[model samples]
Target: MNLGTIGIWSLAFTHGDRGEAREAAAELEDLGYGTLWLGGSPGGNPSGDLATAADVLDATDRVTVATGCVSIWEQPAARLAAAYHALPAHQRARLLVGLGVSHAECIDRYRRPYAALVGYLDELDAASPPLPASARIVGAHGPRMTRLGAARTLGVHPYLVDVGHTVRARSDLDTTSLLATEQTVILSTDPEAARHQARTMLAPYLGLANYREAWLRIGFEPHDLAHGGSDRLIDALFAHGTPEEIAARITKHTAAGADHIALQVVTAHRTLFARTAWRELAAALC
Candidate 1:
C-alpha cells in the first residue's frame, strides 16, 4: 500500500472522542505522515477498531490508517473481512489491517498461535470478498512467525523493537515482505528525565513475556530487562534525546532494512495532544 518511510502510531486515536480524533488525524496528514497507526490491541469486539479507522479515513484525504494490531483470538476473521469489504473501494485501498495472535497471558485460546493464525488466514481467504494478503500484515517478533508473515501476509510489524531486531527480522523475511517496526521516542534532553519517561512507558511491557523473550533473542541479558529495564535496554528500544538525536536513531532503522518506522512519541501526560511532537518530528525526519 506504499505506507512511506515514516508514520505516527498513537493509542489516543483508538480511545479518544471521534471529533478530537478526526482533527488529530487530519493534522497528522497535513504534517506529511504517510500513515496513522491506531495503537492498542482491539478487544473481543472489533467494531471499535473498525470505526476508529473509518473516522481517520473520513478525516484525512490520502494518509493510510492501520490497526497497529487486532488480535485474531478477539476478532474473528469472518467479521473482520465483512467489515473490510463494506468500506468504499478508496478507503479499503488505504486501510492496512494488522493482525496479531495476542500473548498467551492475555488470551485463553492462545495455543499453537502460528497454526491458529494460519487457520485464520484460511478463513479470510474463504470469505465472500476475500481480505487479500497484501491488505494485511502480521505482528510478528520471532524468526518463525516473521517468516510466516512474509509467506502469508504483507510483512511483519514488530512492536517495541530496536534496530538490531530490525536487522535480524530483515534477514529472516523474504525479499517481498514489508518490514515495519515501531519505535517509541521521548523528546527530553535531560538524561534522567528522559529515562524516567522511558521507564514509565516501558514498565508494563517488561511484564509481558512476549516482549521479554524478544529482548532476550536480540541479546539483552536478564539484568537489562529487570526493574523497569536497565539503561542499556531502554536506550536500545527508545530514542530519548533532542529531535536531532531521535532522528538519527530512526535513520538506523531505515539502514537496518525497515521499510517503515511507526514513531510513537512518549509524554508524561497521557492526555496531552501529540500534534506538536508530530510537527517537530516531521520537520526533522520527513
Candidate 2:
C-alpha cells in the first residue's frame, strides 16, 4: 500500500455540494495530504462514494482516493472492484477499496453482517480485480474483523478510536499491513468551545454501539457517552487544542502503530472552512 503519513477523511460529499468537495480535494492535495478518504454513513447511497473518489482522483495529481468504507450491503463488491479497476492505471494505483460490515441497525436486507462481508470479499476476489491486496482496506474494530482484515485485505480502518485501540489493532495485523485509523480533531484553542463543537459533531456516533464499545474498551463508561459526551470522553475522542496539539494527537496514533491517520475535523461550517483546518493540520503533521 502506498498510504503515506496522513489522509483527509470527509463526509463533505454526503452533506455538502459536490463542487465544494472537489475544490476541497484539490486544496488538500496542494496542501500535501496524501489521500482522500470517503466514508459510508447510515442511509447513505454509495454511488456518491464512487463519485467522490472519482472527483478527488480527477482533481489531484498524486493523492490517493479511498472509500474509508463502503458497506457490503450498499453495493456489490464485484461492481465496486470493477469500477476501481477501470480507473486509469495511475488512478487505480491511487484508489483504495475500503470494505466494512456496517451497523446492524442500518442493514435491513442482510441478516448476517459477517457473512455478507465475507461473501462480498469472495466475489471481489473471484472477479480477480486489478487492484492488489495492499490497495484494499477494511473497516474493523473488534477481534474477529481485525483478524479478517489481516487475512483478507491490507489492514484495518478503525473509526472513533484512541491510541489504545490502535495498539491492539496493530498487534492483530501483520507488520506490513496498513493500520489506518480516523481521528476527530477540533482546531479551536478554547477547550470549552472546542468540546462544545466536538460534542455536537460526535453526538450521533456516541449513540452507536460499535463506537460506544470501542470507547468503553478505552476506559470510557456508558455515562460518559451521555449528554453530548462527558468532558473526558470528548477530550479523549477529539483532539481539541492548538493546531500543534491536534497534530500531536494524530501523530500519537501513528506512534501507537497507525500507518496512516485519516483526519475528520469537527467543524460547524462548510467544506472550505474545513479545508482551512486541513491545511493547518497538514502543515503541522507533515
Candidate 3:
C-alpha cells in the first residue's frame, strides 16, 4: 500500500466510540493522511487488537489501515488470517498487519517471544490463504528482531522512539523495506503542561521492560528514567510544543531515515477525541 509520508495513529479507533471512530477515520482520510494506525497502548497496556482493522477499513475509502501491532499471543494465526480474507478484496489490499511479541508483563503466555513469533509467522504462511510477508510489518526495537522484520515482513514499526534510533535503525536495514515510526506529540507551548500530559501517558511504559530496554539502548540513562522520566527523556521521546514545532521534530525523523511518520496527539483530557490537534498538525506537516 502507498502509505503516504504521514499517517495518524490513535487508540480512539481501538477503544473509543465506534461511530465516532468511523467518522474520524473518514475525516483523517480527507485531511490527506495516507494511513490510519490503530495504536496499541500509549502506556504499557495491551492494545491495537487485530480486530480493530476491520472497523477502520470499512469506514474509509482509501486510507490504508494498519495495526500498530497485533500481538501474536492475542490472536491465533489462522483466526487472524481468516479475518483478513473475509475483508472485501479492495479493503484487504489496503491493510497492513503489524505483528508483535508484546511485553511479557502483559501476556500470561509470553515466553521465548522471539521463537514464538517466528512460529506464529510460519503458521500465518501455512494458513489456507497465507498472510503474505509483503502485507505485514513487525514491531521491532532491537537488532535481532529488526533483522527478522527486514528479511520477512514489510519492515519495522518502532514506537516511542527518537531521531537517533531512527538513524541507527535505517543503517540496520537495506535500501528497500519500510521504516515507519510512530511519534507521540503533545500540542502545547507550555513545557509544564505538555510534560505533565506526556508523563501521564508515559507512566505505564516506564515499568515495562521492553520499553525501558529500548530507551536505555537509545541513550537514556537510569536517572533519565526515574521520577516519571527526566525532562530530557520526555523531550527526547515526545514531540511537544506548537504545531510547527512538532512538525519540525517529526521532520528530524524523516531526515534520520524514517519512510513514514505516524503522528499521535496525546491530551491531558481522558477523552480520545483529538481531532483539533490532528487538524493543526495536518496543516503544519501534511
Candidate 1 vs candidate 2, lDDT winner: 1
Where does the lowest 10-residue lDDT sum fall in candidate 3?
42-51
- Judge candidate 2 against the unseen true structure and give its global Cα lDDT, from 0 to 1: 0.78
lDDT, candidate 3, 149-196, per-residue tens: 998899999999889999989988878989999999998999998899
Instruction: Give model 1's TM-score versus the native structure.
Output: 0.96
- Better candidate by TM-score, 1 or 2: 1
List residue ranges in candidate 2 displaced over 4 A.
Answer: 45-49, 128-131, 269-273
Q: Which ten residues in a row are the worst by lDDT in model 2?
A: 40-49
Residue 226 C-alpha lDDT in model 3: 97
lDDT of 3 at 7: 94
Deviation from native of the Cα of residue 72 in model 3, angstroms: 0.7
For residues 1-286, what per-residue lDDT tens digits would candidate 2 score against the true structure? 4778888887774457788877887888888888888756754446434766777788888888888677778777667777777778777778888887777666667577667777777787787653466778889988788888888888889988878889888888888778888888888898999888988888777667777777787677889888888988888878888878887787788888999988888766533348677878877886
The lDDT of model 3 is 0.86
State the lDDT of candidate 1 residue by residue for 144-237, as single tens digits.
9999899989999999898899999999998889999999998889988888889998887787788899999999999998888898998899
Q: What TM-score does prediction 2 earn? A: 0.92
lDDT of each: 0.87, 0.78, 0.86
